[model samples]
Target chain A: MARYGLRTVALVYLLFLLVLPVGLICWTTFQDGIAPVIESLTTPSALHAFKVTAQVAVLTVIANTVFGVGTAVLLVRHEFRGRRVLNMLVDLPLAVSPVVVGLALVLVYGRFAPFGGWLADLGIDVIFSLPGMVLATIFVCLPLVVRAVTPVLEEIGIEQEQAAWTLGSKPWQTFRRVTLPAIRWALAYGMVLTLARALGEYGAVAVVSGRIKDQTQTLTLFVEERFQNFDQQAAYAAAFAMAVIAVLTLLTITLLRPREDER
Target chain B: MATLYLSLIVLIPLAAVVLRSMEDGLSGFWAQVTTPEASSALKLTVVASLLVALINLVMGTLIAWVLVRDDFPGKRIVEMLIDLPFALPTIVAGLVLLALYGPSSPLGVDLAYARSGVVVALLFVTLPFVVRTVQPVLLELDKEVEEAAASLGAGRATIFRRVILPSLLPAMLSGTALAFARSISEFGSTVLISGNIPFQTQVAAVSIFGQIESDNMTGAAAVSTVLLVVALVMLVALDLLQRWGSRRG
Candidate 1:
């Protein structure tokens, strides 16, 4: 009896909170059949939003993947002063509010700020541009790949790499041939998570992107712009598309997560 | 090279926020934080986050317990669904919740633009923290202790309270702290649902966004500093809790 009650409560909470609401959005999007959904997503503005989102997510993922792998290896393989501080700093982005993240970036990189002024003098715009948006996305998604890869790095240890070194493998060769294969699944997992976060980023990008339609507006910003403009169908359709991406990403992560215990 | 990247991306930008907050001195920062709108938003955010944290402490643990201990059909799917909130865009999360609970009549329950709406949005986004944190701990928990306690004639409740609860407490607390920190800083999920009505449904993040929009960088930086401090405190607490859990285990 107790077991049944607990199960029911858990299931009901999730059903109300997670399942029903998501299901309703999909239903709302397609209630008028599929043509409108397609047309809404195919609009020139929507297409532009897609392009910007792709560009930002790709850049963010590439930057973070390189940074994440390097940082994770650094954290696990080496001992240096303030290593703990570095570890904590990696997590600082996770704790920060996205708006705060944008504000922080703007404080240093906005036109009026000292550094930003210098850059602006150089004819380079940071805030309200692609570079600013990418920075914001990278700041927010910084920890995903690192957090995902660190444990696997720790678990694998240095013996394998040392073996390769003794076998006369160069540093880069050992890393490429020996370490890469071992951490590939974890790397893939982290990249997938980073991709998902980059795709869904809203608040920080909103602050930095200036939300210029057909210019800086990503899909998330597009959704908000359309929704507030009372273009509910277009908003819902775009939202539906993002929802699909998120679900697909979740599916990928679910499949990609290495089953260490069974192994 | 990594140090340079870290400084440029994370450290320096955050330092600028703290530095900006104090541009008018400590007194000025304090006054900005204590202003009517700013204070109210902070209060609402803290109070609501506390409530959400407490609720997650219970329901999250319960869900973890059910997932680990109970057998049910569609369990794999439920496991996958636990991550939906994490995966879903916060704006999309708000839209979905608004669809079911907004000014619509599918269920005839509208929470739009209300404080409860804010809590619900927070709950949606923070649902995974406790469950994910506790699930692994619960899986690794030794059933032998529970079985021994039961064999010694202790009731199920007593065994759980004495044996299992002690083990799960550290994880549960850390998860709750994470959820609370997240709730306080959450912006996108609450933006659409809460309607941004000051001293009513507006949260701290939204208030900061408003201040930024009005070019009140000082005020925005002030509130953001407070939130950043809270997040830092939570991270430290989480770090200590992990150490303590490991030690005890």
Candidate 2:
């Protein structure tokens, strides 16, 4: 009886909290048929929003992957002063609000600010531009890869790379052959997380991107704009698309979990 | 190299916000931060986040305990579903809640466009934090202690409260703190569902967005400074709690 009660509470909690909301989105999105959904997604602005999100997400993933791996390797491999502070610095994004992140960018890069004034004189724009959107996305998603890869790097240890070096392998060869394979899954997981986060980023991008429709708007901004404009069907359609991407990422994480555990 | 990247990417922007907030000196900063609108928004954010964290603590710990200790069907699916929030975009999660509980919907609990809506949106976004944090700790707990307690004539409730709860408290506290921080800064979902009504459903993050939208740069920075300070404090506390938990374990 007690076991049944416990299971029931868990199931009901998930049902109300997770299942119903997602199921409602799926239902509303498809209620009017596939053609309208497709049409909503294919509109030029919608297409452009998706394109912006994709571009930002791809760039973010690439940059974070490099930086995340580098930082993780440094944190795990080297003994340095202020290592603890450096470690906490990596978690700043996770701790700070995304809106604050966007605001911080504007403070430093808006036209009246020091950097912003200098850049304005040079005919360059950061805030309310694609670059600003990219920067915010990168800031918000920065911790994903570092947090993901650091543990794997720590677990894999330096022994294998040392062995490779002793066997006359070049540094690059040692890294590629010994280090890369071990952390590959973690890196992939991090990238997927970064992609999802970047794609769905709303607060920071909303603040920085200026929500200029086809110009700076990403898919999430598009959803917000569409919903606010009373375009319920179109809004839900864009939302469903993002939700599908989110689910796909979840599936990938699930599939990768066992492999991660085994290592 | 890492230090430079951290500075450029993380530290410099944070420093810029602090510097900008203090650019007007302490009095000006206080006036901007303590305006009726700003204070109300901050209060709503803190209160809603506390409520959300409290609920998550109880429910998340329950779910984590069940998943760790019980044998159930579709357990893997349930486990996967728990992380749906982390995977789902905040905007999508908000839209989902709005779709189900918005004013026009039939389920009709008056959550949408109200303060409660903010709590619900926050709950969705932060649902997984506590569970994820607590699950591993629960799994790592030595069941033999509980078994030993049972054999020593302690009842199930007594054993849980005495043997298990003490160790689990730190994890729960840290998880709740993380949830609180996440909720306070939560924007995507709350913006849609909270209706953004000032002094009502408006949260600090949403209010910051509004301030920025109106080009109130200083005002936005001031409010953000408040949030940043609170978030930093919570993060430090969470870090310490986790360390304490691990050390004890």
* Reference contacts preserved by each model: 0.80, 0.82
Q: Write the per-residue lDDT of candidate 2 for residues A21-63, one digit (tens) a residue.
A: 8898899889988999999999999999989999999999998
**Model 2 alpha-carbon drift over 4 Å, by segment:** none
Model 1: CA > 4 A from native: A259-263
Q: Could you say which candidate leads in TM-score?
A: 1
lDDT of 1 by residue, B17-124 (tens): 999999999999999999999999999999999999999999999999999999889999999999999999999999999999899839999999999999999999
User: How much is B95 displaced in model 2, in angstroms?
Assistant: 0.9
TM-score of 1: 0.99
What TM-score do all the candidates reach, one by one? 0.99, 0.98
Residue A237 alpha-carbon offset, candidate 2, angstroms: 0.5
- lDDT for position B39 in model 1: 98
Best by DockQ: 1
What lDDT tens digits, residue by residue, belong to model 2 across residues B116-235?
Answer: 888889899898989998999899899899999999999989998999999999989988999999988899989889889997888998898898889887888899999899888987
